[model samples]
Target: MKFYITFFAFILILSILIGCNVDQPTDVSTSSIPIDATSALSGGDTTILSESSHAFSTPAPNLSADALEKHLDGDLEFEAIFVTAPAEVNPGLGPIYNNITCINCHVRDGRGKPPTVDEKFVSMLFRLSLPNGENGETGQSPIPVPPIPVPGFGTQLNNRAIYGTPSEGTVIIEYSEQTLTTADGARIHLRYPDYTLTDTYKPIPENVEVSPRVAPVVFGLGLLEAIPEETILTYADEEDVNGDGISGKPNYVWDVVEKRYKLGRFGWKANQPNLLQQVASAYHDDMGLTTSLFPLENSHGQSQLKQNPTSPEVSDEILDVVTFYVQTLAVPARRDVNDPQVMHGEQLFAQAQCADCHIPTLRTGVLPGVPSVSNQTIHAYTDMLLHDMGPDLADNRPDFRASGSEWRTPPLWGIGLVRTVNGHTNFLHDGRARDLMEAILWHGGEAEKSRQMTLQMTTEERDALIAFLESL
Candidate 1:
C-alpha cells in the first residue's frame, strides 16, 4: 500500500508540472516564434508582394475585371500630359501652374523630393497665404478657419505659365548645416532650410505665410480613407487627458461636394477631406486645371484670371476614373518582418513610443465604391490626426484646423522603399531631412518625448529601430 501511494503521488506531481508549463510559457525568444500573418499584409487584401521600383503603381490584385478596367482607364488619364488650350489632345495645360501631369510630381506614384542642385522644381511646390487678422489667436479657436489667401497669388504660387502669362514667382532653397551628438557619442548632421521667393510678378506681403510641400506617396490611400472616422477620433486626445504627452487632433475642412465640413484625411496638414476632393484639388491647385468640384481657375481673382469656360477643363468622367485609380493602388507588403534584427527594432520602436502617433495596425471599414480596400486589416502606421510637431519643424502656416506647428502623421507603410522608387531619401513637409534618422532627430512638440527616448538609445538600439522602420 505504501509503494502504491508513492507512485500515485509522483504521477500527480508530474501532471501538475505539465499543466503549469502549458499555462505559463517559457521565456523563449520572440524570434523563435512564427511572425504574425498580418504583419506582411500592410494593406490587407490590397497588399502586393513587390520590392520593385513599380511597387507603388500596381493595382489591387483582388480587383474585379470591371474595376480593373476602370483603374486602367484612370492610369492613362493620370499620365496624360496637357498642353495650352486650342490643341486637340489634352488641352488646357495652364495659364499659371506647377506641372503638366500628375505623374510628373508623383513620380512612379512614390514620394517626391526637393529639387536637386541645378534641378527645376518638378515635384515640390510652395503654398502662399496671408496672416489671419481677426480669426482669433492660433490654436485657440474652437472652429477652424482657412488660411487667408494672398492677394495676387491666391493660395498657391504657380512658378510656370502659358505663353504671354506671368508666373507667380520662384522659390530658392538654401541649407545651413548643424551637428547633433547622440547619447552614444555618435554625431549626426542636420540641414536647416531657408526658403526665399524671387522673380515675383508682384510683391508678396512680408507677412505672407509660406509652406513648402513635397508630393507624398500616393499608394495605400484607399486603405487610409477606409479607416473609420470613429476609429480615428478614438485616438484623438486634444486635451491629452491620458497624460501621455501626445495630443492628436482632427482637422475639419470644407468638402466641396458635400458642401459641409468633414474630417480632413489627406495632405501634409490634413487639409483635404476625401480622395475625390484631394484629386480634384490637385488638378485645380497644382495643375491650374478645373473640374466640376473646383470650376474656377486658380488665378481667379488676379488680373491674369481668364473667363469661365462653358465646360470644366477636366471632365467629370476623367476625374472619377483618376480618383478610382488612386483608390485601388495596392500597398506593398512589408519585408524582413521575421528577421531577428527587424523584430528587435520593432520592439524598440514600440518601447520608444513611436507607435503612439504612427499607430502600427488599423482595421479598415468599407470605402464606398472601392470594395478591395474595404473591410480589411492594415498596418499603415498613421493615426490620421494632426499633432503639434514642435516649433523647429513648424511651417508657422495653419491649414483649416491644423495649427502652424501641427502636421498630420504621415503613413509609414512604404517609407522604406522611397529611396528605391524616388531615388532620394529627402523627407518631411519640406524635404529637409536627408534620411530617416535625420527625420527622427528633427521631431519636437508632441513627438518630443519619442525623440528624447530615441536620443537616449544606444547605437545598437538606434540601428535596430531604423532596421524595423526599414522592414515596414
Candidate 2:
C-alpha cells in the first residue's frame, strides 16, 4: 500500500511539471501583463515554437524593364506635367513644392542616398509635432493639445525648392563619437549628431516638436500592399499576453476614400496603410506633384506660394502610372547563409532575442495577376506593428494612432546592398547612424537585450555579426 502511494505521488508531480511547460491562457485584450518580477527573456521554450509558421517563399523578378513601360504608358501623362523651364506651367505641381521631378528624390526607384559632399540633393525631410498620450491604461481617445493661435512651425521643414531660390535654408550634419564598454568587457562605438540650420528666413520658435525621417527603400512595396489586412493584424498583441517584454500593437489611420479608419502598415510611424496613398503623399509633399486623391494644395494655409500661378494640377493618368511603377518593384533575394559569420550571426540574432520584434518572415497573400508577388514566403524582417522605443529615440511626433516613441520595424532584406544600390552607407530614420554597428547601438526598448548581448561579444564576434547584417 505504501509502495502504491509512492507511485501515485510521482505521477502527480510529473503532471504538474508538464502543465508548467504548457503556456498559460493569456488575456490579449488588455495591455497589461502579470508582473512576475523576472527577466523579460524568461518563460516559454523557443525551441518548440516552430519558425516554419513564418516561412514565406519569395518570387523572382520578371527581368524585363519592358514590363514597366506598359505601366508607365511611354510617360505621356508625366511628360505633360513635367517642367521645361523653372517658371513653366506645372499642373498638379506644388504651390508649396519641394523638388522639380520624381527622379529628383527617388532617383532610380531605389533608395535615396544623402550626399557625402556639400551638394544639394542630400537635403531630406523633418516632420514636426508634439507627443500625445491616452488618458487611461485602457487606451482612450487621444487628447489633442490646446489650441494655439498661428501655430508656429506647424509642418514638415522643407530643405529644398525650385523656380528662383535653392530653398530658404540648409541642414549641416556634424558628428561626435563615444566609446562604451559592455558588462562582458567589449568596447562599442556611438555617434551623436549636431544639427545646425543656416539661412533661415524666420527665427526658431521655442517649445516646438520635431522628428526626422529619411526616405526608405522603394522595392517590393507592392507585395507589402498585397498582404491581406487581416493577415497583418493577426500579429497585433496589444497586450503582452505571452509574457514577452514586447507589446506590439497595430496603428490604425483615417482612410480618406472610405471615410473610415483602416489598418496602417507603412511609413516610419506605420502612418500610411496602402502603397497608393503612400506614393500619393510623397508626390504631393516631396516633389509638390498634386494628384486627384490629395487635391488640396499643401500650404500651412499661410504660405504666399499657395497662390503661385506656376503650380499646375496633376492628372489621374500620371498618378496611376507612377503608382503602378512603384508597386511592381521587386526585392533582391537573400545572400549566402552558408558563410560561417552569417550562420553564427543568425543564431546570435535569436539567442540575443532580436527576432521578437524584427520577425524574420511573413508570407505574402494571394495577389491576383501579379505572379511575382503572389503567395510567396518573404523574409522582409519586420512585424508591421508599433512599439515604444523609449524616450531616447522618441521623435515626439504622432502619426494617426501611433504615439511618439513608436516606430514600424524596418526590413533587413537588402541592407547589405545600401552602399552599392544607393552608393551611400547610412541607416536609421534620420540617417544618424553611419554604419550597421552604429545602427545596432541605437536600438532600445525590446531590442535592448540584443544590443546589450551584441556589445558583449568580442571584436571578432561583433564583426562577424555585423558581417551577417551586411550580408542581409
Candidate 3:
C-alpha cells in the first residue's frame, strides 16, 4: 500500500510539470473572438446579418413597430427629390446648391465617391472659408471660432444652380499619380488630386480655403451619438500623457438649437453637433432647402439669395422622421470571424496598436428619442474624436474647434460593405485613397506609428491584415 501511494504521487507531480510546460496563444482577447456569438454582432441587438447591396439601408432590427414605421416614412423623405420652389411635392431645391436630394449624396445610405473625370459633382461638395483675421486673445482654453465665410459665396461652394441663378463656382479636379514602395517591395500608386475653382459667379478671394468632402455612410450614427460625452472624453489624450503617440481632441461646435457650443459628433471634422443638425444642414446646404432649425437660405449672402420666406421649406415632422431614419439604420454584422487568416490579421491589428484610435469596442449610453440605439455594446471601431491626420491629408480649412489637420475618427463598421453598397472603393474625406491598403498607408501624425508598423509587415502579414478588414 505504501509503494502504490508513492508511485501515484510521482505520476501526479509529473503531470503537473507537463501542464506547466504546455504552450498557449500569446494574443490578447479581441472583439473578433466569438463570445456567445456576440463577436459577430457589431451593433448588438440592432445588428442585421446582411451582406447584400442594401446592407446599409436596413432599419434596426430591434426597433419597435411604430419606430420601424417612422423609419420607413423617413426613408421616403430621404429619397424625395426636391425641385425649384413655387411648385408642389418637395419643392425648394436651389438658387444654388450641390445636389437635389439626400439620397443622391448618400447613395443607398452608404458612402459617396469623388466625381470621376467625366462625371459631374453628384455626391461630393467643397467647403469654402476665408483665412482667419487677428482675434486678439491667443491663450483661450477652448476656441470655438467659426470658419470665416467667403463673402457672397458663404461657407460652401454651390456648384449647381436653378434657372436665372449662377452657381457659386465650378471645380476642376486633376490627379497626378505617385508611387510608394512598401518595405515588402509592394508597389502602390497614390493619386494626388489638385482642385481648382473655375468659373465663379463672382470673382472670389484667391486665399479662400477649399475643403472637399465626400458623403460618409449614414448607418450606425445613432450608436455613435448614443456614446456618452464623458465616455468619449475618456479616450481623449490631448497631451499624450500615456506616451502611446495618440492625442485625440473633441471638437466643440456651435449648436444653434442649444445656443451654445456643444461637443461635435458628426461630419468629416465632427463639425455638426447632432444628427438633427446634420440632417437639417444637409437639407439646407446640399439641396438648398430651408428647415425650422436653419430657416435662412444657403445662398444668404449672394446676390441671387432669395427673399426670406414666411416659414421653413421642410416641415418639423419631415425633419424629425428623416433624422430618425438615419438614427435607426442598422449596422451590418461582421463576417468571417472564424476564418484563420482573418483571425490572424485581427491579432496582428491589435499588435500594431491600430486598435488604439480605431477602438474595437464601446458601450452606448441613452440617446434621447432613439431607444433602439441606446444602452448597447457596439464594435464600431472608432474613438469618435479629432486627431491630427498630418499635412498630407489636411484641407487647410479649419471648422469650429477642428484644425485643418484634424479629422474625426470615422467608424469602421460597415466599411467593408461600402463597395457592395456604393459600388466604389474610394475613401477618406476627399475620396483620395483608392483602396483599403492605400487608406491604411495614408495614415500619419497620430497614426504615423501604426502606418510605420504596417509598412514593416511581411507580405503575408499585410495580406492577413487586409483579409481581416475585408471580413469586417
Candidate 4:
C-alpha cells in the first residue's frame, strides 16, 4: 500500500511538471507558427476560420455545450429589436437612445459606419462635454472640457427619442476632401468630417467638445478580457522610459462590479473596465434600456417620462447571456498568411515600428466563468493601451485618464475583412479613413515614425506591407 501511494505521488508530480503543452509563439521572425497559424486558429482553438461575410458572427470552436447555448440565447437577445416605453416584452427601449438593438449599430457583430450626408448619424454618435463643468458657467480662459453628464442630455447625443420627449438633435456630417501622394506617387483622397447638431431640443453649451465614436467590432473579446493585467502592464510606458517614441499606457477606469479602479480594456478610449460593464452601459446609452448598472432614464432629469419596463429594464439572466455572446464571438482566421508577399510585408511591418504599439501576440490567462477563453495564444495585434494620437485624431474630449489626443490602439485582427463583412472599408474611430492605407496615413503623435516610415517605403514594399495587414 505504501509503495502504491508513493508511485501515484510520483506520477502526479511528473504530470504537474510536464503540465499541458502550450503552443503560444511570442516572436515575429519568419512568421511560421509552431502550434497553429494565426488565421487557422485566431482565438487559439476558439477560432472560426471563415472568410465569408458571416465570419465575424460565428461562435468560437472551443465553447462548451452550455456556453454555446448561452451564446445562442445572447445572439437572439442581441438581435431583438426594442420598442418604446410600456413595452410588455423586451421593454424600455428609450426616452432617448442611439439605436434599437445591439445588432443595429454593430451590424453583423462588425464595425459601424458614419451616416451619409443626407442620413442622420444613428449608430455612430458624438460624445459631448463642456470646458470645466459647473451648475452655472464659470469664467475661465481656455476652459477645460470636463465630461460631465450634460444638464438635459447625457454625454452621448441620442437623436432618437420615445413619444413625448424630444431628441437631443440630428447631427449633420460634412466631409472636406484632401489629397496625399504615396512614396510610389500614388495619389489618395482623404475626407475630413465636421459634425453639427441641428434642431437642438436641449441647448448644447457653446464651449462643448465633441468626440465621435463609431461602433467597433465585437470578436475575440472574451480572450482579450482574459489576458492578465500584469501582462498588459509590461507594455505600459507612461513616461516613455524606453525611448521607443511609443509610450503605450493602461487606462485605469472605475469598475462598477468591484467598485474600484481596474485596468481599462474595452471601448474606444478604454473607459469601461470589463465586458459586463460595457454591455450594460451600451444598454443604457445606446438603447435607453436601463440595466442594473444604470437604472435611471437617460432623459437627464427631464419630467413627463413614460413608464420604465422594470426597475432594471433588462433582467440579469438576459444581461449575462448577452455579455457572453459579445465576449465569446470568434475572431476570424487570417487569410493568405503564408503568401510570400504577405510574409515580406510582415517583415516590413516590424521594420516600420508598427509593432511597437500594436503588439503582435498575447496569451490569455484563466477566465473563471468561461474557461474557453483561457490560456490561449492569440494574435489580436493590440497592446490594449492608450497612446497620444496627435491633433489630427484628437476630439479634445477627455475620458478618465486618457487625454483628448490619446486613443486606445485598436486591434489589427480581422481588419482586412471589414469590407467583406460590413460592406465598407471605412476605418478609424469615426469611420473617416476610406481604406487601410488612409488609416495608416492618419496615424501621428506616438506613431508618426511608423507613418513616416510607410511614406518612405518603395511602392513594392508598401504593397507588401498592405498585404501583410490584409493577411492579419
Candidate 5:
C-alpha cells in the first residue's frame, strides 16, 4: 500500500512538470534587445515601407460628386432621423431599444468616451447565453434562445426610449479599488465595476448575463473587408506550430445571402464577416430599425413594442448608402514611432512578448474598385481570436463560444490618434482604462505573463514601452 501511494505521488509530480514544459519551445529567444527604429524604417517610400511593415493606409472614400452627394444626403437624413422624437407617427420604435441612431453612442464617426461624474454616457449593454459545447466545438444548439436571461443588465437594459413612454430603467454603478501584484513583482491598482440600480419599471431576472461594450472607431472598415479570407484564415492555427501559449481559431459565421458559413472577421468576437452585414445588424439591433433580413422588432418579452412588417425604415436604399459611407471612411496614419520612449516601448513590447497575439502587420486581399485597400499591408495589431483575459477583466458573459474573459485583440492602428480623430482618449472595451498605461496594467490571461514582465521593468523602460504604444 505504501509503494502504491508513493508511485501515485511520483506520477502526479511528473504530470505537473510535463505540463509546464509542454508548449515551451527550446528555441525561445530570451534576449531583451530592442529593435532599432531608424533601421527598421530606413529604406524606401510609403509603398515599400507599407508592404514590409504595418504603416498601411485605408482607402479614401470616393468623394466623387455622386458619392459626396450621397454622403451629404445621408448625413442630413441620419441627423433628422436621430434627433426627432418618435411620435405616434413613428410607430416602429421601441417595444425596447437602446437609441434611435448610431450617432448617439458613437458621437460622430469617433470612439465613445466614458461618462464623467455628472452623468453616464448613453452606454449600450449586450447579453449572451452559455453554449452547451466543449472547447468551442459543434453543439446541440447555438444562437441565444430566449428565457436564458442575461446577467446584471437583465437581457440588455435599453436605457433610452421615445418620450412620454417608460424610459428603459436607469442603471447606477458603484466602484471599488483593488490592488494586485503580477508574477514579476509589478504593482497594479484597478477599479472593479459593481452594479446597482435605484429605479426599475420591470424587475430583472435573477440570472441574466450581461456585458457592456463601448462603441469602437468607425473608420477604415473597407480595408478589413478587403483582407482576403485566406490571409485571415492563415493566422488561425488551432494546432499551435511554434508551441506558443496561444492557438487562435477563426470564427465561421452564417452568411444568409451566400447560404453558408463564412470566415468571420468583424465584431468583438469576430462574429460578423463583412461591413454590410455588420451595418445591417447594427441598424436592426441598436436603432430598432428593421431591414430585409430582420423584419421583427427586438422585444424584451414586452407586449408594448412589436415588429412592424411594413415599416419604411427597412428600405434597401438606406442600408446601401449607410454601408457605402462606412466602407469608404479612411484610417489615419500612425503617430510618433520615432520617439525614444516609443522606440523603447516597441522593444519592451516585443521582449515582454505582447506581440504574440497583437501581430504587428497584416496584408490585405484584393479589392477591385478601391486602390487604397487592395493588396495592401496594414498594421492592425490583432490576432482576432477570443482570448481568456482572466476573471479580472471577465464580464462573466458568453458570446457564441467566447467566454466572459475572451475578447478579440483590438486593432492598435491609429489608436494614438483617438484624441485627434475622435477628440477623446478613453481605452479598453468599456472605456474603463484611463490611458494606454492603464490598458497595459489591465492585461491578464494569455497576456498576463507579458503584463507582468512589463510591470517589472524600470520606470524608464515603462516610459519607453508606453511611448511605443503611443507611436502606434
Candidate 6:
C-alpha cells in the first residue's frame, strides 16, 4: 500500500512539471527576476528618458559645456529650412529634393513613416538601381551586385522637385491584410504594404529596381560607430559555420572620404562607413544639397536649364557640426523595467530567440571628441551585421556587399519612445508594421522560428513580451 502511494505521488509531481512547461490551464507566471537596477541606463552616459514629444531630440546628459554648444550650433543647421538660392541665410534649398530640412524627415530625431495612397513621399525615399550583374540561383548563397546608376534620375528618385523641372516620380502605397492565428486560438492581423510608383518625369529602365527606405532615429549613432569593427565582425557567421542557422555578414562599401572599401555600418543595408559620410550622402540625395565629398548636383547635373544651388550647398564647418549633432543625441532610458510583466517579458524575449540578432549588450571603443559615446556597456540590441530577413521582406535591391534579401539588423534601444517623440509606432525598414506585435509577426527567414515561437505563446505571454518591449 505504501509503494502504491509513492507511485501515485510521483505521477502527480511529473504532471505538474509538464503543466508548468506547457502551461495547461493557467497563464505563465509573472514573477520578477532581480536584474541590475542600472539596466535602465540603456545608453550609459547618453541615456535620457522622457515621455514628451522631445524625448528623442535631447543631447547627452553628461556632455561637457563646449560639446553641448557645438551640438546646439549643429541643431540650428539641421533644423534650418533651405530655400532656392539668392538669399543669404540658408539659401540652397533644391532644384530637386525630397524634403527641405533634415528634421522634416527625421521628425525630432525619430523614425519616419511611409506615405499613404493619398499622400506624397516626404519622410520616406526610394532607391533606384538595375541588376548590375549575374543573379544567384538561390538566395541562401551570397551573390555579388555592382550597382548601375539610372540615367537622368541617378540612384534615388526625387518625386518633389523645385517648381519648373518635373519631379522624378510619385509613389502610391497601399496595404493588404493577412490573418495569423496563434496556437492558443488568438488571432493576429498582419498588414503587407504594396508600393506603386507612377507619374515619372523621365523614362525608367525596364529592369530598374526600386527600394523604399524610411528615415530612422539619429540618436546614439556615434556610439554605434564607436564599436570596433573587429568586435562587430566577431558576430558575423556568413557561412553559418556553427550551424545555428543565423548567418550574419558585414557589408563592404565604398568610403568616399577614405576612397577605399571599408566595413559598412550605417543605412538600411549597412551601406555607409560613418556618421559623416551618412550625413554628406543624405544631404546630396535627400536635399539635393551637395558638400565637398559630393560636389555634383543630385540629378547628376542632367539639366542645365535648372538653377543650381551653391556648388556645394553645405560648407565643411556646417557639415561637421551637423554630424556632431546626430552623433551626440541621447538614447532614452528604459521604462517600467522592474514591473513583473516587463521582467517576465525579458525572459520571453530571450526564450523566443529574438536576442540572437538583436543582441542585448555590447561595449564601445574610444571615439575622439565624443567621450560620452566611448567605453561603455550599452543595450542597443543589434549585432550590426546584415542578415537575409526572408522573401517576405525582400526588396531584391542590392547595396555594396549586401544581398537583395539581406538587411542590417536595426537597433532597438529607443523603439518604445518612438510614438512619444514621432507620434507613431510604425516599425521596420519601410514602416510596414503598425505596432510591436505586427513587427514581431513580420519576422521570417533567420527569425522564422522566433516568429513561430512568438505565435504559439499564450495571450498573457504575448502581453508580457510586448510589455518588456514597451519598457525599453
* TM-score winner: 1
Candidates, ranked, lDDT:
1, 3, 6, 4, 5, 2
For candidate 3, give the lDDT: 0.87
Q: Which 10 consecutive residues of model 2 have the lowest summed lDDT? A: 41-50
Per-residue lDDT over 1-472 for candidate 3, one digit per residue giving the tens place of the 0 to 100 score: 9999999999999997775333111111233345665767888767877799988998887777689789989999999989988887888888889988899989999999999988999989999988675321221235778888899889999999999888888899999998888898988888989999999988999988999999999999899999999999999998899998998999899998999999999999999999999999998888888999999999886788768567999999999999999999988888888889999999988988888988989999999889989999999989999998888898888888788788999888888888899899998999999999999888898999888889899899999999888877
Candidate 6: C-alpha lDDT:
0.83
The residue pairs that clash in candidate 3, if any, are none
The global Cα lDDT (0 to 1) of model 4 is: 0.81
Model 1 residue runs over 4 Å out of place are: 1-36, 134-139
Candidate 1 C-alpha lDDT tens digits along 147-219: 8889999899999998999999899999999999988898999999999999999988998888999999998
What is the lDDT, from 0 to 100, of the residue 124 in candidate 3?
92
What are the runs in model 6 whose C-alpha is more than 4 Å off? 1-35, 134-146, 304-310
What is the clash tally of candidate 3? 0
**lDDT of candidate 4 over 1-472, digit per residue (tens):** 9999999999998886564211121222223343445444567767765789987998776676688788989999999999875667777778788898999889899999998767766568888766554322321112222367666666888888877778888777889999878777878788988877778785777777678999999989999999999999999998899898988877777787798878889999888899999999898888788878877767647542555445888888989999999888888778787789998998998999998888888999998798889999888889999898888898877776777788899999999899899999889999999889899999999999998898888889989999988877
lDDT of 2 at 1: 100
For model 3, state the Cα shift of residue 226 in Å.
0.5
lDDT scores in order? 0.88, 0.59, 0.87, 0.81, 0.59, 0.83
- The TM-score measured for candidate 1 stands at 0.92
Candidate 6 C-alpha lDDT tens digits along 160-205: 8776667888778878999999999988898888877788886777
